[model samples]
Target: MSFSSFDRKKENSPQPSQWKLLRQELLKYLECFLMAVINGCQVSAPPNRTAAMWEDFITCLKHQDLVSSAALETQSCYLLTKTAVSRPLFLILDDNFYYQSMRYEVYQLARKYSLGFCQLFLDCSLETCLQRNGQRPQALPAETIHLMEGKIEKPNPEKNAWEHNSLIIPSTTCSSEASLKLTDLLLTALENPVTYIEDNVEQKKADRIICSTNVLHQADQMLRRIVSQTMKEAKDEQVLPFNLKLLAEELNKLKAEFLEDLKHGNKKYLCSQETVHIPDIISFFHYEKDNIVRKYFSKPH
Candidate 1:
């Protein structure tokens, strides 16, 4: 039977599918801009028709609260222009993109912007796809799936270096697991040399902050150890009750000086080395303690 006949016989139902839910989850997980061609199964159509479908999909996304209702022209321009500054972007095109010419255009765009590009092919068997399609409220005619199967082309790494990072996800996997797997794959792809350079700068800054915090913690420990030792020695000799107030004031001054030095110290030197020189830190504290001891003992009281 013809697809038109099949369509006429069935009631028009707009119930959402599992694929829709998966798409929503991906969008939320990425929290980034997206551009997709959301068309139902159809035979080959004119390029203009495809463009119209894209516009309709954008409208539907807004209605479903999936995206904002920003001006279409400005939004497209903004997404393209600020691709680097934005969190991340995902542009999903139909699997029917079999032509090398079409793939080349996409490759050029990714290359121009130094963006990582990966093609994810849903590798499902013909029977499996047909079975799933049969369960849909707006099921495509069996013949349509058959036609698509013949026309579909798998990604080739050697032939297309730009799309070398392609992934093939099997349809047999559970929906939730598949979504997670795809998420991980995309994250890994983001680390490709072409894209990692942009992300590495932020990572380096975070590392520096952690390293600086560790240095401050070490300084704090060194000061506390020195103060504790001095008080214990004074107590052993029963010397003026070990002057708790004086110990605290001296420790605070030493900490302030140490922190000042750390602030101006070579950050690269600190982070590259595995351990700070504990002996050097101890020596500095010992010198400070001697001055405190001398001044305290000199007082006649």
Candidate 2:
């Protein structure tokens, strides 16, 4: 049957206690999205020798182009069929899947199969990751961790178009808490998959605001450094007629020019979106400038 017809049938079908049903159904399929980490950063390994050996074999085979390609195709078909027979469940693959750029193709598969796709990155510092690797029974080489660190591309919701539902879990997060958080995020993503595009736009807007704020802060710091250095040089040289009033006027002129330059340079980003208040940003700078003037210029030289 066509997807549209199937969707129509689904829409017409009676679903009692939809949320409860969904939650229970999802719990059953949770294993689908619980991807294993084979990047030498796993905090624990399976105690079973056979399981560990199998995992190691899979990891090694994944490095071979022909084997990996065949494996991915087989896995995709299995996942697609499983999803078709039941509610959409998370498909958890290893980090190596993302490194190989197969995650994008998987994402496409999810869309084609009408499955919800989200990526959860278990974020850990290099030191922490390496330390964890050391604790494993079959410890991976430090060089392996280093190689994966350089090769693995972390998912970004704002930048990666396919990673609209991506989330980063910090190393400090407890397992239970992380599981709960992942479940919540996945449920939300599944329920609102169509909104991913809109969510991405909002994410970009937030990113732009943060970048602009950082630029303003850097500019303020630059101004303070310049003023302080100029005053110190003047004091050392014993320049005549150098006073607070003269310094204030010079600093004000510099601030005005800097503000003008900022306004002109970031006109596109600043003016394009009305999400951020330009006046509020300007006021913050004004307050900072006044504070700097009061603190430094008030002192007798």
Top-TM-score candidate index: 1
Question: What digit string (tens of lDDT, one per residue) describes model 1 on residues 201-223?
Answer: 55454445446556665777777
What are the C-alpha RMSDs, in order, of all predicted structures?
A: 25.3, 18.2
The reply for model 2, stretches above 4 Å from the true place, is: 1-88, 98-100, 175-177, 193-301
Which run of 10 residues does model 1 get worst, by summed lDDT?
1-10
Global lDDT of model 1: 0.53
**lDDT of candidate 1 at residue 135, scale 0 to 100:** 99
Cα lDDT listed for each candidate: 0.53, 0.51
C-alpha positional error of residue 73 in candidate 1 after TM-score superposition, expressed in Å = 9.1
TM-score of each predicted structure versus truth: 0.38, 0.36
For each predicted model, how many residue pairs clash, with residues at least 3 apart or on different chains? 0, 0
